[model samples]
Target: MGEFAKRHQSPWPIIVCFALNFSKVVALLSPIDFLFYLFAGFTLAAGVGVITARNPVYSVFFLIAAFLNAAALFLLAGAEFLAFILIIVYLGAVAVLFLFVVMMLDINLATVRAGFVRYLPIAAVVGGIFAAQLIIMLLIWQQSETPPTLNALGNSPMNQPNNVYALGRVLYTDYFVAFQTAGIILLIAMIGAIVLTLRPRAGIKTQVISQQVSRKSSQSVRLVDLKLGQTHPTTAATAPTEPQEGSA
Candidate 1:
């Protein structure tokens, strides 16, 4: 037995073979499952790339790739409505916005990373706490008696009229208050973001709405009476000239 154990020290090779064979079998059994795994792999890889990339633009691209993969996963999971919304709202709008912002910003990587070491401990602690909470929640969910259902109408998701209808019913009926609260929170966040990034710079011309609204026609327009053939000289042209020493 000792000799046999020495000959095969680890079962990793067998485990790897089994895992590959299992995945192949699942892929063959259900194409959707295969697509789900493919998208999941893409999402995971892109998510890692987002954090690891040196260039902010590359990071934003990776994040958009991750969002696209996530949308694919959502589609494979039969949440077509959510998949489309995720693609449209996140990848189409939010990711593009992030990309534009990253491209436009004059980011100094060295300056941004200067305090990385100082904040590393706190960031690590927060990340660990978040990971732990996710693990605990997942474990609790796995052990729960009720199988996960997307339906909020007391019917199984399979029996729902449609994905959009089901989601709307849930959002408006069971989670209405929560939905409104989330909207309000999002609105506040949007306002806060606008306020934080907005700065008044010298020499930048901006329209003052109050000044515009309060202005009279006389301030903007001057009716000048001139002779038929005479041209009106501008202030610069009509200004009294300082005579040079050599001139009259």
Candidate 2:
């Protein structure tokens, strides 16, 4: 059994050697290999911590660290603009907002788990679909062979770099309209989400913005004071005139 398992899983040394070979190619092309390694290592550690941390605060902190490291890696990958945007937009804004929301929320673990049994079937179906799709993809990819390299094209990948640079240029120039359209679609989605969250309830009353602005305070407030205490002259025992009439 041990021998079969060993055959199934490659030795640690082989895996290490394969990793070194892969990193060597990247390091050869990469100008700042040390920076990339540090960033990549930090990202990996942070990612693990984010998922495994018991405390939500620690998880959020780990996630932020991961995002920062990922941004650094993105910058190293030659997407400096995108890297900065990720830091500014996602890390700075989204992470902090989520962190605050997480801190503010008091989760009822028991109540939340009440539906787990009911939803298990649906969850299983979704999981099965995902697994099936993934297996199919792996089978297809395994069966497909690599395309033959054209010797006429440069042997070095640097000579004909991946579509990153060309894609960026086209995105900013020729496909700018399409990019804006995509942005608009995202904007619409955001608005739709906001609308969905703004559900009207029978017991809850909400004032219209236009009506609220036009509302007068005079109509809402009126001065009406009432006096409850009355003179108790007859009920008092210190009445001299009543005593004289009783004696006569």
Candidate 3:
């Protein structure tokens, strides 16, 4: 009891020691390196969650989390524009759209999961191919002799006044042709998707301009004289009749 009371009464020493050790570790790593590792770890964990989550909606949320952590990593790397793009475009728009769509869809989990085993061999082959490609790329990158390059604007990032200005300048000037080409490709893809998905369906109403132009008021409209209390005869005849309460 005395030992327990002593340990509980003077916990400040342990707290101070832990703080000192943490400060030393932070000093060795620097705040930037520490934050990079922190965000990177979070991004990695979120990516794993994205692939492992059973629910599509949960997977989308995990993907969003990964995007957010990646944005933080980008911010730490001084690419503020890319960071915000990840946040606003990918997270705010794309990921949220995916989440809502997944939630709204009537998905059959049993049907989806049933395909996993059947496709496992194909998936494994694809995964192995990708893994091999990645390993080869990593080895090639490690053996490359050329030093890292700067932004496309031929200026160091530190010298630029703002990231957006530098990025826009590079994109519009140095890579203008490639940028336009990408835009054209995206436009073509969008057109193809629209064409494929806009196929006509049965029982759908469509406008006919020539028919509308050739139509006359006399063909579509009817003028009838009726008493104030009487309904139109055509409507009266076409109306559905309800069953009498006791007759059925």
Candidate 4:
């Protein structure tokens, strides 16, 4: 019975076949295409790890890895601006924020894992729909005709030695208002976040700008007339009380 079960259920042969097929498929891709697939695969795997990791810190690390892999993929696609933005913005700031939040929150891992497992089916369905949409989009993009190498402003990308310079010229020249508007929106969001999270504690003292600015010398200072030898009333030593009888 053991032999029969092992022969029927052992997956080694199937795994070997799949591996061979995958190797054959990989061998057909050019070097650049291989690197693209490599980075893309890492990005996908890291994204999965971010969500599936039990430890929140681990999830953040995985998220950082995903960002790095995605940045590499962007670089391979000649999107240097986007790649640097991913690295500088997401990896530098957002990932650090996620890590700090995870560390400081002191989350209950058991409860989090339980909740994740409970909602896993729903999450899986949503993830499947998103994956399907992404696949369809990718297929359509692959089939679509490539546009001319010229940019929106009638400038050839090849003429610009630096992608950043080209992107900046177009952004500042044509889309300056929109860019400033985005900055304004981001500023508002930052202010809103600060307002939402800021709480006043009963015993904590905070600097009041209005009160400080409005204060006059008279409000903060007291004029006192005194003899040359006399100190301020609050600073002068009190006369020692006569020792209470038998108190010592």
Candidate 5:
């Protein structure tokens, strides 16, 4: 309690949270947990910096830091599988791929800035809609102070008749056909839309009506007349090759 009191005065209690959790490592309060909390805050700050950086390369670095911090938080929450997955899938793999792609893609700031004036109106409308949605969500959320928690009921309808797993079970199993049908409908609509907008572009290879109409078999082929002339033979290896032994 004294350690916490000292921490509260500094306006930074992450170290306190880390120390409190770390002290429980030996089946008791782990003192080192305060460090993890502090680290998590730094990671979040780095992630924000990365997103705001003008250079895509710097942003990728910040993204990596954020994923690492998120994984740390997951571990603190007792989710080892999720924590490792977050690090491996996001930090180890996806971040590197994004870094490589960003490095390769050439982005001209001048070209991008040129379109700002023309797109300002559309951008403003979209931004306004997003702001409105955010305000509505915040207002609805602020109406309640208590944090949401799931009731661990065994006989939940989302699961089996008397079981409780997750709401996803019925969604994936019972509604899988609907999902597939929706996918096929989207595919057909996409194909139809593509066909609707297709235009025969100029200078493309195609059969010409004029060429076909003017074509004639006689013009395409001719039998050339040649005068018969006697010519001396060069040489003969075997006039008629020794007759294959009596095979007349």
Candidate 6:
């Protein structure tokens, strides 16, 4: 039976048939579906490029491209608010910040890349663990009788506002604690970053709020009583004397 199967099999025919079927399916796709596929492809490619690009600046640009494609995907999925947030927060702020930091920092690329091999094992293990968890979750979701509901306030009726309202409602209600925690964590991270980057420079003048606040008027301004047409003695010594007409 194996010999007969091997002899009878013509892989080219099967390949051609599959190709034809794929082409037919592609032809059948709506414009929206085609655009979605295009965006998905760009997103995936840009995501890969972000990690693999040698230059940090290029990596940041790739990351920004990925963010843009992701926002496009979100828009396609009808999550307009998420799309805007991704564009505004990630593309506008985070990606630009990353680019600026990468450009501004004195990073030795060779030194940074030298440790890649050393860290590869740890990265592989962590990635494997994450992949396994994702697979398990996906399996569980696929086998589950009911699909998961993201909206805690229950599915909105067709007449109601779309994903934005649903997301806000659920976020402020069901996921409020998690959202607040995330905000607090981000705030702490921002503060930590500022603290780390701040360095006191020697010989640089800086504002002294305490000194300014505690100063007496006498220390800053002296009220001098002088007879008319008499200059202060210190000022008279420092002031340039008018050139004598007879001096050579």
Query: How do the residues 77-135 of candidate 4 rate in per-residue lDDT, one tens digit apiece?
Result: 67778899989999999989989999999998888777877899999999899999998
The list of candidate 2 runs beyond 4 A from truth reads 1-31, 108-168, 197-248
Q: Please list the residue runs of candidate 3 whose C-alpha ends up more than 4 Å from where it truly belongs after superposition.
A: 1-24, 128-155, 202-248
User: In every candidate, how many clashes are there?
Assistant: 0, 0, 0, 0, 15, 0
What 10-residue stretch in candidate 5 is worst by lDDT? 147-156
Backbone clash pairs for candidate 1 read: none
Q: Model 2 reaches what TM-score against the true structure? A: 0.49
lDDT of 5 at 197: 95
Candidate 1 structure quality by residue, lDDT tens digits, 34-130: 5555787799999999988989999999998999899887766667888899999998899899988999997877887899999999999999999
Residue 115 alpha-carbon offset, candidate 5, angstroms: 6.8
Give per-model TM-scores: 0.68, 0.49, 0.63, 0.62, 0.39, 0.68
Give all candidates' CA lDDT scores.
0.73, 0.68, 0.74, 0.74, 0.62, 0.73
The per-residue C-alpha lDDT of model 2 at residue 114 equals 82
Backbone clashes in model 3, listed as residue pairs: none
> Model 1 Cα displacement at 74 (Å)?
0.6
RMSD of 1: 10.5
Predicted candidate 5 versus true structure: per-residue lDDT over 124-228, tens digit per residue = 999899999998996786374431222333322322332223333443565668877998998999899899999879888987999779966454433334447
Q: Model 4 — which ten-residue stretch has the worst lDDT?
A: 239-248
lDDT of 2: 0.68
